[model samples]
Target: MIGILGFVAVFAGGRWLGWAARWVWLLAWGWLLVLLLAHAPYMPPELGAFVGGEFRGWFVLGVLAALALAYRTGLRRLQGRVAPVVAEARPGAFSAVELDRYARHILLREIGGPGQKRLKAAKVLVVGAGGLGSPALLYLAASGVGVIGVIDGDAVEGSNLQRQIIHTDARIGMPKVFSADVAMKALNPFIEVRPYHRQLEEGFAAELVAEYDLVLDGTDNFDTRYLVNRVCAAAGKPLISAAITQWEGQISLYDPTHGGPCFECVFPVRPAPGMVPTCAEAGVAAPLPGVIGAMMAMEAVKHLTGAGQGLRGRLMIHDALYAETRVIGVKRRAGCAACGGG
Candidate 1:
């Protein structure tokens, strides 16, 4: 019992004091050899002869095992010292676990380690945890964006289960922001999720837009969409806004600060009353939001990482029923209202 306790203490201390790691196995094996040599004298005549003959073999085996342990322990300690130096040399260095998690992204020449680092350093605010917000938030979190803020005043309902994929049926009646927060955090434990369980009002929209590097407007209503657009434009932050209704969806990045058209450049005036119907009133296809929202997430990734050409001055329109996709060039309307004349 004393020997066992002594062995445990030595092993723990050796591992803790890394400089003593290589000698631990040597000491342990030497102690075992001593015990065997001491006990050999008291054994029976036959046993004594057998022990004398086997001593050389046992000694050789112990030495070999001790050498192997020494090599392994020394290498581990060396690696432990070198890892921090390597991490310090590279900006935004990732841990072994993080590198493995984002291995696929790192492999992409377009979005390699530098791009992944940018994704990790980005801050994106997504307005409305509804249809378009669902997939956008999910993919953003999965992509490793460092911080994601989700704002919504509504709660999950039985009717929302059709298009809002982030909210599970069990989460019905829960605040949409909280549901989204749970989903995003579950998808990527590395990212931060901020849930604003309130509506996006003009009084706070400007301040909120200024806080984020980018804004994604997935709100279902025209009022909030225009509000987000104006605030993002005023703050010079890029905005990725997408809308889905019935069978079609539209998405674009509005950044007049960088010469891209703002949201109001294309739609200077809201449609005449009753000209356009809400998704709730007109009914959207289940997959329409999924398609548009995923695209919105993709655009956000591109914008943050500078990986590929973004939808800067172009609008992407997808018609699910017709199986058609089109891109239209939109220019900033100079001398007009909203983002113009600034």
Candidate 2:
């Protein structure tokens, strides 16, 4: 009740002060931080202990409860309030069972308990349930990444069973996202899988990508890839893009952590009409996206866990026909356009 009254007083004062308080959002966040710190364990020993031994206990509990309620209420009342930032979902302390189950990953110096925690807290949205999307979804879910969202509007056909490994004969007619969700759940029930069985467009893509920590472009078309890039750029979400054509494939990370080039920076815009042939028209080799898709998944895991150097600012190209690979360095444009000056 005290916390509530204090917040009410501040809000009223802010309103009376008019435009001096530019944003109530910041005011709410500021008050929330103050409340958390006041309820922290830094009080004197007598005030920190439970019972009368700690003047801090009841006060802390009451203030925390009040702050939490106020924070939620203010968010619902504010404009442009986003989902609460969930601490970046990095790894931290672990239970014995998690240690045993993830012994290999935990044993690695790069991805100790903290890194695994981050991975477990990550929410990734895979944009396609087809070729590249299939492998990325499976690997990310199996890796114990906490939440995975699969978005696709297509239905499974008999032909998709070859590369889209998540779908089965029994799920041949099911929506690809729903089918993949079931398979992923079966693989690791511990992970939360959100399946979206609808086509993504401009506004909806913005909203969907905004909710996730990162996005993976498993899509195969120029139009969808452009759409995904625009959405991720606007929403400030990292994006991993992979494409397969004939016997060749490429993977790139449009991550902003390095302040490097985004997918838009590299591709700029879609090629002129007929400038590039579609995989459907040109006939992609069956194993092409599988090999590249798995790599894309690995990059995502590495990124989520901060395990090692990611593909940020670098594009990887592979040609299975000739068994050759190439790496191209990418740089964020100073004034080229798109995300640069935005």
Candidate 1 local lDDT, 10-84, one digit each (tens): 788788888465498677766566545734656566653443435555567567877987898899999987744
lDDT for model 1:
0.85
Please, what is the TM-score per model?
0.73, 0.70
Q: Candidate 2 on 197-242: residue-level lDDT in tens?
A: 8988876788788789989997877888888887777667889999
Clashing pairs for model 1 are none
Instruction: List clashing residue pairs in candidate 2.
Output: 89-118, 90-117, 90-118, 91-114, 91-117, 91-118
- Tell me, by TM-score, which candidate is best: 1
Cα RMSD (angstroms) for every candidate in the order listed: 12.2, 21.1
Candidates' lDDT values, in order? 0.85, 0.79
Clash totals, every prediction: 0, 6
Model 2 residue 64 lDDT score: 82
